[model samples]
Target chain A: MDLERPLPTPITPECRPYWEGAREGKLMITKCRACGKPFMYPRVSCPFCASRDIGWVQASGRGRLFSFEIAHQILNKAFKVKTPVVLAMVELEEGPRLLSNLVGIAPDPKQIRCDMPVEVCFEKLTDEISLPMFRPVGGAR
Target chain B: MSDLARMRELSNAVGIVGVDESDEIGTLPGKSQLTLHVEAITNAARDAGIKVSEIDGVFTAGQHSPATIGEAIGVVPRYVDGTTVGGCSFIIMVGHAMVALYHGLCDVAVVCHGESGRSGVGVSPRRDTALPGQFEFPYGFGGAPTYFGLITTRHMHEYGTTLEQWAQVAVSTRKWAALNPKARNREPLTVKDVLDSRPVVWPFNILNICLVTDAGGAVILTRADRAKDCAKKPVYVRGAGEGSEHVMLTQMRNLTFSEATQRSGAKAFAMAGVKSTDFDHIMLYDAFTSGPPLMLEALGLAKRGEGVHFFAEGRSTPGGKLPINTNGGGLSYTHSGMYGIFPIIEATRQLRGECGARQVPNARMSLVNGMGGMLSAAGTLVLSNEGSR
Candidate 1:
């Protein structure tokens, strides 16, 4: 198992656009046409109003660090080299939070703070899959 | 009738006549998860002094069907419930059982849970295979510890909750473990010990995480009136309610507190016609050290962001204002993956005056809170001695 690449997530019909967008360097979120509520972890319908009239919108690719943890002991063998991995929850500027990895910075609590500004960075793991990771904006790695 | 009124009508309509566990609480390597369920169910039936055939309703949470359980137990249940959320699934089943008894859907109900969390003998939910797996797994969302670690981290960042406050939870729970002969880890623990423990996930050391043991438990419910005919005194279910917001932790609107717990606790209290202050004992599921404070806030016993303060103040510890988790909790007791059932059993034991050393003095009422699915699902139960109401 390569530490640089973990297992790929199984794509479903509802989330195919999300992966496709990541591959194109665009972070996608669903906006409900009826209620105008936006959400992540893609959906077939608006989670709030159950609106079928949903469209994919490019996210600002900017977010804030809501919370994070430095997994000192890697649970997944695929990320063994990335010990002390920065697993984080990034709340998008558009109003939904999604789980992602924080890169381009030390995986230390002293370096990470809640509400820190972050921008999306895509990691092209395969021809079809690209993981959306976040990094501290203008911060030293 | 309003939902609360309907719940109130069901309140105390059913009583828990029996509660028991599998042959062991921790590390039964040779036993299968199904065997644990059978053992627990059989023990509960024996404890209730009722034949297995009397159970007209069979309910469980996670990975198993009523048809499978009924076939194993050798009875065809008229009603079946398999509501799988996570650890709190069993607690939610109890609430469902009360309604079933009240509505005459079944005369007797058995709620069971069994897991081979440590042994790895049973089927466990694979987050990597779920719909969100595409988003979660690749980035190292391993399981409960990482998921809960994020909540704990955000809570600390928001509430100024310190590491010592988290460690204090482990310290206090260990004191409770010292009194229970069945508890796995009974040694004295200190804040320093917790802080010094090896890290599994950030903000959570080995002591902060629940022990993964293989165990199972079951509880039997019957109509309150029929409970009088049982050999053992019944622990009346005065109130019960369940709620869920989201299964994934990332989607939770608020990271500092659980909305499901607040809703469920409020509904349970309203149905029981009581408040948080009325309880003689409390049992909040302790899957992780961070849970107690968060749950305390959700239950309205403590203010938001003050859960750590509430726990640090020694309010929930032994010889304190409100005795909690007298069975040592999942922190020091057995946590066979889903820890919801043990608290219900402990609450029942406390209400019946059956806990010898760990007994709450003359305990008339007890509150039990069970959580599941990354603090996504919550079930609260308000129970009392038969005479309390």
Candidate 2:
């Protein structure tokens, strides 16, 4: 009864390590080895100095929800039933901002506010990947 | 790089020999997007008394791909540029093309644009790219309503600009739309109507957004000496300016005001030797209703926090003075998604006294602005009835 699992969204050579690390339930961010400024969304070059001396480090997976919107409706036809999704951009405690889906909260527009505290939880959608979704520290179930 | 010299050189070099448009577009049915573009192009060339084969350069920007338009227009340009910003892009691209023509890149350049933005041409239900910001769109970010919502929230938080003040801009542009026969939202819109409109995003209602429309516009530019031989009045390209910063609103720093748009305008005004007060009427590209008033503050037409003040007083509306966006803008006018190109078309027509009912009584000089992305890329242009040789 052995069946091969589905292939993950083929990660490129430049971004393989980030994926491999994510499977370990660790979210990683890149920074220039020369300068310590934080970077998001794994890039080939350092945005700060345009330097290629980039390295990845594990994030605390903790952040503040800088800005957010609770969507009561889904825009795309495919995601039509997935209404009430809270899409948020979180400014990590490390000073790099990244966009993520805010889980564990009532997806109501009236309740969300800026500067709310949140922590990351990895959802293992596949054996090769774990998505970094966040939830309010004391959010609606 | 600034296009001030290019604007003057264009005025002294090639001139706009043609002025024309679509048949007052609303929701045109039974017409393909490409068909609409070709119709506008042929109409403009015919109005200019020129043939399609004679056009050496053809440009399409914003949403329309250069390859798609070049194939549709039946003319392969020696030079092609498809810089997607907002509607103001065509105006800036015209400035760049003038510089290229000065270098003998191409001769008769025609700027054309068409899109079924309202119809949503096969865009994915999810975000398009794996760009750094894909997660935001699923939650309904980056739509016209959302982008302006972000700006409006920040503006209110920082400067205490009120929602009524934001509504006033929609109110003022609609007043101008009422006079224009071509304007889609001809019925006058009150500030209350704008405020009462359903909120797509917080602080932004439906009236605050540009309508998704199927429309097209075209303009012809050629040698100044040759322009005099054509059938219509040639509005001189006085000064042109352009600049860019970043694309996504979440990524850009200091979203307080559009520095890039203001800077582009400053360069244009300085090169043209005209202040904001010098222009008789302005033909700024208005994608969302918030764009015009924000531009008023950004371009120094009104002071900071004074953008709302400029509109709330009723002085900025119509008869009080400092008339703007006489085309009803994208909000009330045709919003083909590439809105910048149409302002140039309208400015040329207005300067030529072609605007029948919407004509500004004695419009002499016009300042035009094109805004692309999340106010990331911008272009400002100056056009004058004082045609030069």
> What DockQ does each listed candidate score?
0.73, 0.21
The DockQ-derived docking category for candidate 1 is medium
TM-scores for every candidate against the unseen true structure: 0.97, 0.86
Score candidate 2 by DockQ. Answer: 0.21
Give the per-residue lDDT of model 1 (tens digit) for B1-389.
Answer: 78777777877888999999998878888989999999999999999998888888999987678888999999999999999887888888898999888889999999998888888787655534755567777888867898999999998998888889899888888888899999999999899999999988888899998888989999999998899888799999998879998877877988988999999999899999998889989898999989988999989988887876655435667777788778999999899888999999999989999988888889999999989977899999999886343
In terms of DockQ, the best-performing candidate is 1
Off by over 4 Å in 2: A1-25, A60-65, A70-72, A80-86, A101-141, B1-13, B62-76, B120-128, B132-134, B137-142
What residue pairs are clashing in model 2? B13-B224, B14-B222, B14-B223, B85-B372, B86-B372, B87-B339, B87-B340, B88-B340, B88-B370
TM-scores for chain B, listed for all candidates = 0.97, 0.91
Please report how far candidate 2 places residue A31 from its true position, in Å: 1.1
Give lDDT tens digits, candidate 2, residues B1-389. 36554444454355677756664466776556676677888888998988888777877775457777677767787888877666667888778767766677887888887665666543224433455333343334545555555665556656777778777778888887888877788897888998888756555677877877877778888766677788777777777788776666656555658888888988778767778878877876676666776777888987876766666544656665666777888888778777777788878877888777777778888888878876777898888878654
TM-score of chain A of 1: 0.91
Report residue B113 deviation for candidate 2 (angstroms).
Answer: 0.8
